[model samples]
Target chain A: MNNRQILSAAIGSLLALGLVSNASAAGKKMDMEQCYGVAKTGHNDCSSNKSAHSCAGQATKDRDAEDFVAVPKGTCAKIAGGTLKSA
Target chain B: MEKPANDSLPCIAGIGLRAPHYCEVLEKLPKLGWVEVHNENFFGGGASLRTLLKVREHYPVSLHGVGMGLASTAPLDQAHLSALCRLCDAVQPAAVSEHLCWNSVPDMTINGPMVINDLVINDLLPFPYTQEALSHVARRVDQVQEKIGRRLLVENLSSYLSFTSSEMSEGEFLSELSRHTGCAILFDVNNLYVNARNLGVDAKAFIKALPAEAVAEYHLAGHSIRDGCLVDTHSTQVCAEVWELYEFALQHIGPRPTLIEWDSDIPVLAVLTGEAEKAQQRLEEYHACFK
Candidate 1:
């Protein structure tokens, strides 16, 4: 094959691989709000001072307990590792 | 007027009344011969205790304990015993029962399903039925009986493994303990069925060997299949095989205060009442044969 054609094919393969990896990674990301919704309804919220409707406070406390690291704004970098990041 | 003889429990069939259905059962006042509840669940005076008190007004309640650690080498938990005594005073349960197994150890090595070193697994733990173990269990039973100011029924546990060092059979240990402590037996038919299938223990021999007169109650529950063995998950409906075993037990041991126990994935009150009705039918049939 010609050198130009070979270079074009190599670029195409890398782009395809990147897209596949991104798609796989995207599948792992969970919607935190949806998870909170399920937990609020599914389990008995035994948090002493908070009602079930105020689950946002419990979620914040849980996130704080895990020392969760938030993703930087305006950056498409990979999220930090932890259950909260996945959520 | 004198209170009726408590010995009449042998002719009744009851259901394990859990928290979820307490209000409905008490409000509707279902025709339950008796009701049993886990003693641990009502240790503290709260909504659960209040509900149980209301139910006690209408039915005879049996306090079945799940966390006594009767055979544990560790010192008996005073708090647990005190809680039980308090409950006994409040509810005046017709009978109280704990399992014939250990869930704790001395050197902080807890033995049970969910263990964290010295901490108990919050589940019953089976042990080898050696003479020493029997003596330990008997002593514990004696203490529980003394504290409660009444006889305590010890239930046979459904075990997954058999220890190579077991010096005697579970039935022998239980019979011997009863002889020594005068404690009653709560003969759980489902546990025997599970052990018979999983550990090659003979269910018929177990039923036959138990001292009939000492049997104060019977427990029937459903189990789930796991890894080719049956675990007493108590989540679903009682299987036909277990029900048949209950009938066999009723015939062998005679009708006793049988309980339909469903702990997890509990259904509506009607479902449990339906199961209790089945047991009541079997008990009535047994009574018919005797007559």
Candidate 2:
């Protein structure tokens, strides 16, 4: 078999053995909520408006715009002073 | 607060798991006594947490925090503590630890009602070793332990400066902190060596002054010297001087779960395992002599 045929056969074997799942399942559905103003300083997960450090554990100040932390869905609305929309 | 008699980490050498080698470690499933990762890195769900969970299946995991800021003068970050507790519930790690340093300060209020700055240094910074600071840190430790529902290992900091207004040595402060709050110490030998070279801290005295029973783990790592100051860079291999210090620690404090930490310019897995094997050898020598 050529490279493409060999790849297909391997994937077919995995599927037959129940070792692989569909694309949606493989994507690991987003069950998280982005809660803003709750991230601790230097612990934010991603980009923020105040400073564009653009990575985890790099937030210079606390509660900046778009410095959201991934929380359980629907949990963000419950935290006092926590907002879904960043200020 | 009553302290646990011992941590659950194996009394063998382990390596600090970093990002570069995650794939290789998972694929190979090498013989590591345990693995530690920074707590903040795996706080939220996604590829990072998923990858860690997969790695967790093979090795006992230790959650070490760098962002808790236990000694911050600002009010304790409740959100951070809650996230940590959630992680502990999920990971069920062998031990959890943080540094004895501060990273936050109260927001600055300018002339009158105008708020100016929200100061939060991302790095671990040292504070004066005074009675007041001790009381402050003790309360915070108690709070963290209470929230986490387990003992927290507080590590000594590698500082570049010392406070002349300080009332005690860092060792005494840690001893008193453990005594008062029942928290354990994560004794970093290289940190002590660095502080000694940088600011004239007495390394042996610091080791001897610690309550040995309260020491639950040992950290061995490499440092770099810049402009006549030894910086705890954790970028290179464990040096001969640090190994001597580790042996000294073994003789004085007895064997504990030791770790070889290389955070920057990380080498291959074999290199880290080689460093860990070096530590394991010394640990075994101590065990053999005692037995």
The best candidate by DockQ is 2
- Candidate whose TM-score is highest: 2
Where's the lowest-lDDT run of ten residues in candidate 2 chain B? B282-291
lDDT of 2 by residue, B1-291 (tens): 676543689889999987666766776789999999888877777556766777788999999998888888888989999989988888889999999999888867878897745478888788999999999999999999999988999999988888899999999999999999999999998888888888888899888889998898999888777667777778788888889888988999999999998876668899999999999999898883221
Task: Write out the backbone clash pairs for model 2.
Answer: none
Which parts of model 2 are misplaced by more than 4 Å? A1-87, B4-6, B109-118, B288-291
Residue B154, candidate 1: C-alpha displacement in angstroms: 0.4
Q: Write the per-residue lDDT of candidate 1 for residues B17-80, one digit (tens) a residue.
A: 7646655675589888888877876777644566677778888888888788899878899998
Q: For candidate 2, state the interface root-mean-square deviation in angstroms to 1 decimal.
A: 10.3
Alpha-carbon deviation at A44 in model 2, angstroms: 15
Q: Best candidate, lDDT-wise?
A: 2
Model 1's DockQ score: 0.01
